[model samples]
Target: MTRKTLILIAAGGSALLMLGALGFQYIGQMPPCKLCYWQRYPHIAAIAIGLVALWLPGRLLPGAGALAALTTAGIGFYHTGVERKWWLGPESCSSQPITGLSTDDLLSQIMTAPVVRCDEPPFVLLGLSMASWNVVASMLLALIWLQALRKS
Candidate 1:
């Protein structure tokens, strides 16, 4: 396929993934955690790049789209590690120590704590979490972007 077509496909892929995520969150009643939310930003950026790539006459935008895809893929892997307890995650998203807190303080903490967590995957398929799937999809999108670059 031509580079233009590849870029369009890659961008569409990102958009579809983002839409699915939103569907899971809003329609399926699954709230996204901090890390899950982090994974969306790059896709949004990539979509923008794709839209601009259609009008632009160079490879810069498509290259940026590739970088965006890889960035999300990297975040997905990090989120997968956090889900599997392979390593510690950010303090804000992970459970924190509740030691030495008075009853009222503890109550307040629980009430104000985030409903979602980055340390666990809310949905999984065939033993792979959403983040893992995102990694796979984003990597594929990245490759498409790379192929577009090569063609140009």
Candidate 2:
């Protein structure tokens, strides 16, 4: 296939994945955590790069798309690590110590806490959490982007 065609396919795949995520969040009522939301940005960037690659006459688009894919993959990997307790995630969304808080402070915290957290994995498939799957999928998208780059 042509470079443009390949980039289009990669972009379409990313778009579909994004739509599926939104569907799960809205229709399925599976709200995304902080880390989960972070993983979507790179796909958005890749889609934009794909649009540019489709119309622009430059070889750099594919490289930019590849970078975007890799960026998401990195975030996914970090999120998976956070979910698995390999490391701490964002302090704002992850668990925090509240052992010594007053009653009023505790109540305030309960009212202000996020509905979903970056340290928790709410969905899993075949022993892999959504973050893990994102890592794999984003890596695949990166490969597709790289292939487009090679073709260019």
* Top lDDT model: 1
**Candidate whose TM-score is highest:** 1
Write candidate 1's Cα lDDT for 27-140 as tens digits: 998888878989999999999999999878787888999999999999999999999999988887745567999999999999986678788788899999999999999999
lDDT of 2: 0.87
lDDT of 2 by residue, 1-152 (tens): 88988899889888987998899899978888877788899899999989989988667999999999899899999999999999998877635577989999999999986578787787889989888998898889889988999998
lDDT of each: 0.92, 0.87
- Which residue window of length 10 is worst by lDDT in model 1? 89-98
